[model samples]
Target: MFKLIIMCLKSRSNKSGVRCYQNRPSSISRSDGRRSRFGFVGGDIGDQNMWRSRPRQIHINRFPPSSKVDLRAALPKAVQGSKGEWAVDEGPTLRWGIAPVSLMADDFAAALSVLPEQHHRIVSCVAAYQSHALAFAERHQVENVYTSFEDLAKCPNVDVVYISPLNPQHSELCHLMLNHDKHVLCEKPLCMTEEQVTKLLEKARARGLFLMEGMWPRCVPAYHYLRHQILRNRLGELQNVRCSLGLPVSQGRLGLYGGVTSDFGVYGMQLALWVFREVPRSLKVSGRVNSEHVDIAADIELCFTRGKRAFIEVSAERKLSNQAIIQGKNGTIKMNNYWCPTRLITEEVDFEFPLPGGDQVPPTHYHNRLGMCYEAEEVRNCILKGSNESDDFSHNESLLLANLMDTIHAELGVGEIADRKQIPDLQRQIEKVQDIVEDPEELASETCRVVQDVSSGTLETKQQEEEAPPRSKAIDAP
Candidate 1:
């Protein structure tokens, strides 16, 4: 009789704090130290006595259940095959990795809930904390849990990594993943600056690796239908887009990225850009900022080519309609919950694109999060087709949105809270350098060089100070 040996690799805590065992098969060794291919020991192939004398360390469970049996139960029916399945020859499966399981965790989970298991799998996860990684792993049935982003990037099994860390960390993480030759799908805003966005895009292109901003709105079925209609001039002489998105998030939650602009405003900006398909001619921006230099609200007016324009309002301190209206000479297209839209309305028709229903819905903080699966599907398709970016949310579009955010932030004078925190340190360093370098011309040159190097992350002011010659002074005589 063939015997199966089960080994408990580890017991990890799930999201609910329940400990679960991760079991796998282990090979058994014979008394003479020879390995047994079939996990059996002893000299005879079918000796019952030899099988009984097998190493006690090996727990033989003759009818051991498969580890993946309960995996489907943890996911919704959408991923469990309630929806249509992919064909057997669809393509190679894409193994996915996710990092820093904090913000957008629900959205990722929701997307995975709807993605077909055969085509994609959440194989690895990385979190800043080991406990968080373990919990996410147990909850998602992910096979690997890494506490470092670098480890996730280095994982050979992970073909793609979805980065959803804080806004400021997006660029650095993207560079790390891209350098490792792993495809990246980052959540918006892709970066705090247009320059950063440009560098990331260039790196991705040069490396021939896929990179995309997880702008799920662009992948929504309703948005696709709306874009097709506008392109066909069904709306007639596109005039303007008016969009507003707001939620009463606390000041503490805004963190260093500041207020609604980077957090919520990018949605409206991208929507207008998607509609116009061109950069704006000029911008008129107005907003409210708190004492902490965080932008609490913003209202922007974008002037596009041919006298077309878009107006957007976003708020982090208060709640607003969160709806969008696109008006043209002939008719109007209105979207409900425009950011992650499921419904669109026009004069003659009301269109609804509902989420794929299942007995269990994945836990998510945002509304209509299951709709994110569309974007996930798009990423898979793009990767399979050997494309680096999605046509719906191309790199150029992301750059445009980043530039618009940079302009809006500059206009409001509420730069990223993280950047603002470094202002005093930079100013102090400049003053110190000025004291050390007496000549104005030399001072100016040195300051410019150091600042430029610092901005590029190639040098540090402290190191420069240490390397500078000691200040010379004439000794006073009495």
Candidate 2:
């Protein structure tokens, strides 16, 4: 049986804004699949129409939306150079530069910090506020280190930059790099607003430069495997998506970062968008706010057409399951540590009442930049091909995600950390897209239509089931 709960806020007089809270639902027993006594009373289950699982089964041969593009096919094969090391056919070998000493930057460099000539060459390093860049460069034996942004930007040989600076500085640095004809792979939550993202995209396009958000999750091997399986349609029509992610944060940073929404919410949002490849028609969000008036926890409900929906929860105070569950008519796919999926569990057989354990499996781990290398490889390919946007993480996808964050920030009453009025064009552009954002029901319907269109065979199966006589039992016991 399918169940849904929508929670929203009502204005309660307070300086911060209205805070919404609902009593937690009682835990339902797994073995019996019985509704708990603490929650709302159960309704009639005798009616087959209300309880029967949808009969749509996506054919395995057809490609689902997840696997529509090949992320690695754009690059040509490596060839022998005068140095006898592998090199691309294009002109001189690509040179890389690292910037701004930060944990994210450190992680990137660590992957490339191996023995010289081991893989790609990152020849330049620069850090603004931290002295560790020199140490990092020395340890890695990098030849040049620039203290000023100007020197790094002006360097003629530096082909690309892996930018993971403070969130607020992303716009300024991205513009600087693009203007200098340098390709960029900026970290996720690229900028605070869609206006900034659009401007950066246009700038990169005009300059003929490669630019991509470092959403490492999209490039990993496990997700690649998941997408491949999804494309084969083993699960049937995706009816629901559930994502939960959380991380413990210092109290001071919690309010400034706007808690889980800005931090882990994007992962949830990204997963949902990837599944449907459409904007949600409508969304309802309610969450707790810290004393600083920033959201620390949020429960988000996204409605898509054809009665499809997603429930996503994000929190900053404690660790979460950090998993994403994609449920279809026939089976379910569970991704552990979904943000960086090292493991994936798929249950392809008929989904029984007490979901069978045999169908579920444990996650298998892989070692590839902890999976960050996949995104790095994508950046390298984009740079080599002279492409402005990635096939996997497209410019439109970035804009949609930015706009979605804007909506969340405004709704949650944690406006931009930096004022938008400083950039009048951005403010105006953001205002323009607000009206076009789909209502929840509209988004749902649009997604459902896409699902139906792609899974035509599944629709036929549903039709066949409708013509057949009803089954005697609601759910058969194992």
Candidate 3:
């Protein structure tokens, strides 16, 4: 049964803001004497429309519309109601509060639309601008709209917050929501640095709140099938994983803090980690950076135990095969659009899992993005079970991925976008080197000398310098 209980705030003469509290619903026991995880008993799991025949209920408590209210004091504790508090019977619907209307936020809403109404609902939203908040509220049918994170954090009815801002804003916003005792599911690349991700994990653990990186692939059915195959020894001893993802784009990705490795390569790296389930023994990376010192293309090799390895190539300059192949001693498994896979091929069988919302265009920016619903369902399940982290994409996995990204960025000499002062210094150094090798013959000789030193692991010999051609001729020679 679905029920809605909304507690609206009414201004009182002396109190700064209105405060309300409602008791949480107890789990309902089935005829077999087992309690349903989500407090409701329903038909078979495969019947998607079974909930439509059952009753539906929604409970939303609106935050005060005043700036003078002390949010910390107005908010309720994470635990259930205390003595003497009014109790309201409600369903197990988890209230969601989204922030900063963006493409990802819309995608999340679309995903929620497909889920059972008794399990999840969007009750509140926070936007940077009033107009955006109004528009998002109108479009999503959300009644409570706030413009600041502080206000969103003060909302007592919001059970969890789905943060989908820019890449850099992820850490700060996640901290805010967790501090407010709200569960969080932030987008991938949870933080800009490994240390930041560590801190967030620590905070989530200390607060006893659920936290997960929105690496949607981990929650999809195809990935589950692949994991099953590995666990059952269907692929034998895994040896190699080769994946490539790339796109031909210029402006948005080539700017500061915009790198193809972080934006596109993370999917491949996560997949490799999922297969190997351990840290690589040693790794090597080579990538080309644009004039802004941001990586545009990269070739990464991760060497693991027993000579197993993973090769990944990611680029923003052009398109690649966009496929992942896992080679084992017994057979190979290939995945198309491995990042958000819908098709899987093994020697024994070919599996296809099409995305939800058939024939309806998804409200997402990327391909096969409707798969995001799987992750949303994962979050709902975890929160309902009172878990602090998901086994599919755990804290340790996120930490490993963050550390890997840090290593790749450091090797590529890509600095944080916030560090603007280093750009001029780097440009000046380049100019100084150019000034020293102004003559074409001198430049060509220096290049040849460096190449010889690198190739032979020794100083340049006279024969190497003698073989060097002029810069113009060398350019045409290649």
- Tell me, by lDDT, which candidate is best: 3
Give the Å shift of residue 308 in candidate 2. Answer: 1.9
TM-score quality measure for candidate 3: 0.67
User: What TM-score fits each model?
Assistant: 0.68, 0.64, 0.67
Model 1 misses residue 41 by how many Å?
Answer: 73
Poorly placed runs, candidate 3 (over 4 Å): 1-91, 360-363, 416-478
For model 1, how does the per-residue alpha-carbon lDDT over 1-478 read when each residue is reduced to its tens digit?
A: 1232222323432222111111122334434353321222111111111111111110100111112223344333323343333233358878888877763664676566665566668899988789999988888788999988888889999999888877789999999999999999998888887668878888999999999998887877667656555644578888999988766666766755546788888888889876775556567889898877778899999886678889998877666666788999988877757877655666554554545534356545556666677777778889998999877687866765765676677668776512211111110000110001123222212111111122323211222222121111200000
Of 1 and 3, which scores higher on lDDT?
A: 3
Off by over 4 Å in 2: 1-92, 113-119, 255-258, 348-369, 416-478
Off-target runs (Cα >4 Å) in candidate 1 are 1-89, 416-478
Please write out the lDDT profile of model 3 over residues 97-187, one tens digit for every residue.
Answer: 9976776687788766655556678899998898998888887789789999889988999999998777778899999999899999998
lDDT of 2 by residue, 1-478 (tens): 1222222233332222211111122222213242212111111111111011212221111111112222122211111112333222333445777766555555566444321233356778788644677876876667778887767888877888888765667889889988888898887778867667768888888888899887777765455445544544557776999988666666676544445676668888888866654445566788877767677888888776566788999877766666678888977776655676544454321110110011121111221232455576667667766777775677767776776676566567765433232111111111111111213222212211111132223322322221121121211000
By TM-score: ranked, best first = 1, 3, 2
* Clashes (N, CA, C under 3 Å) per candidate: 0, 9, 8
The alpha-carbon deviation from the true structure for residue 264 of candidate 3, after best TM-score superposition, in angstroms, is: 1.1
lDDT, model 3: 0.64
